[model samples]
Target: MPSHETTPAESVWDYPRPPALQRDPRRIVVECAGQILADTTGALKIMETSHPPVFYVPPGDVRTDLLRASSHHTWCEWKGRADFWDILVGSDIRALAAWSYSDPRPPYEDLVGHFAFYAGRVDRCTVDGYTVRPQEGDFYGGWITPEVRGPFKGGTHTHGW
Candidate 1:
């Protein structure tokens, strides 16, 4: 478990809108195609209302050499534009498995150069040794930890949420 956890489990409903970014000390390890995609104890989490926290690993901690920039892009009202990456491993190419805000908007600039992977796309993702459940649906990338309470965004009929 992460020693930095100072409070009880958090309810996503209590997370603020526009989101909040805070440094996290928990060990985060992600695996994909039987490879260690990323490993870090220094991570950041983006918390938003109705959503579990999204963990972002610093670019330096990720296996960037195994990732390629893809043409896919997305826009977020809070984080601005994000670019996707495809994971290339041993004759296998996983498309759009990771994303980063190469140039995030103000307030979210700290996320620039950091990468967040889709838990469902990767073989597995663990926080403090606990495997995470990917946020429902394909549109979001929140990692559902036991410490998070959610009526989370994503899944069917949550488009306007």
Candidate 2:
């Protein structure tokens, strides 16, 4: 059984099933290879049931020069197809560390062209000074923050969730 020892702010279980995008004004930062890859207050967060919120940063806030398009793509029934990117900082390379929905489907169209990074693959991902924990599965890029409590659904035993 998953512990429900969550903060008083929000519960992941209460999130919606189809997911909803909301503008998050919190400061979001991504750092890797001793460099700041992205920093922004204008981020969009996707909230869904049994999953931590995923923050999407605007392209203008990211260091685009450090990213190279990878030959990776994935489909999401709600958001549409996503394109991956390899983060190249100096000589260090993190393959498929980031992704974007270039042309999202309805309701999620605001995510088009915005980027979301994998907290596990990056040196650090912080929101409002809280370090984020990456969603357990390699395929999901949700970022778990302190204010959200979860019996999140990405780990080994959560397959059926």
Candidate 3:
């Protein structure tokens, strides 16, 4: 058993309905499918209620050559339409492992073409050298580092919240 107590610096419940986007200068790295997928210190982080921070890495920092665009698309009330990106390395193909918004809603225009990944769908994710724990459950692609405590929403019984 693990301790669940926290004196959190930020609470997901306190996050705004519209979410807040900010430039995060910490080193973010993703290694998956036996490849170094992306790395950058110039990522933007999105904070929303009941979710861990979602870091969006600029395209220039990613291995764009390894990505194959997927026809799949989903709508986010705040971020506008999102297009899924599949990772292709040799014969391995990971579907819908990452997402990008080529044209974001007004508040998130800075995120255009930035890649946000699902840690659970990949091998590993890290922030400033601390290994990241993917937000529980499947839908949300949040990065949970040591600093952020949460009653995160992606786990069981936390849906539609």
Candidate 4:
């Protein structure tokens, strides 16, 4: 009957590897719209955002061929140097749909040189086999990882999504 509950295994409040972000660096991939971009196992899922999770994958894992450098940029107090990328879809190019950390501050060195994509710009986004829906009003995907459960965006429980 409680709106919130905790399990011995895990909970949103406490993550096992808190500060040090670890990426599988195996066979992780992301696809959006009809574009099959980013195919690398080595990706770091940073927990800097609380409402939704954001993942930063190395540029090598990302399909840079379809990406265009953008003038737009955002800064994080913890992380450093957030660069933006525009996605090229045929004749149309979406602006500021992707970002990367050219230089990162201490404690977030692993995320350095890695990039994160904005789910909102793409028609669709997927990780492994599960489909991820972009978070509203933000650049994040809630469905690319295994840590999520029910009541996700686009789910039956999500009336607003």
- The runs of at least 3 residues in candidate 1 whose Cα sits more than 4 Å from the true structure, single-residue gaps closed, are 1-7
lDDT ranking of the models: 2, 1, 3, 4
Report, for every candidate in turn, its global Cα lDDT versus the true structure: 0.92, 0.92, 0.89, 0.62
Clashes of each: 0, 0, 0, 5
Once model 2 is optimally superposed onto the true structure by TM-score, how far is the C-alpha of residue 93 displaced, in angstroms? 0.4
Q: Comparing candidate 2 with candidate 4, which one achieves the higher lDDT?
A: 2
- What tens digits encode model 2's per-residue C-alpha lDDT throughout 30-91? 99999999999999999999889999999999999999999999998889999999999989
Ordered list by TM-score, greatest first: 1, 2, 3, 4
lDDT (tens digit, per residue) of candidate 3 on 41-106? 999999998899999999999999989999999999999899999998898888999999999999
Candidate 1: tens digits of C-alpha lDDT, residues 30-102: 9999999999999999999998889999999999999999999999998999899999998989899999998
What C-alpha lDDT does candidate 1 achieve relative to the native structure? 0.92
> RMSD, each candidate, Å?
2.1, 4.1, 3.6, 7.0
Error of 4 at 117 (Å): 0.7
> Could you tell me the lDDT of residue 19 within candidate 2?
93
lDDT of predicted model 4: 0.62
What TM-score fits each model? 0.94, 0.94, 0.92, 0.72
Candidate 4 Cα errors over 4 Å, as ranges:
1-10, 15-20, 25-27, 139-146, 149-161
Q: After superposition, how far is residue 3 of candidate 2 from its true place, in Å?
A: 23
Model 4 lDDT per residue over 1-161, tens place: 22222412223234333434666543455665577777766777764323345667787777888988889777766776688888886787878888887788888887876777777776655555445556545533433344443333333345454
Clash pairs for candidate 4 = 25-41, 25-42, 26-41, 28-41, 33-124
After TM-score superposition, what is the CA distance of residue 107 in candidate 1 from its true location, in Å? Answer: 0.7
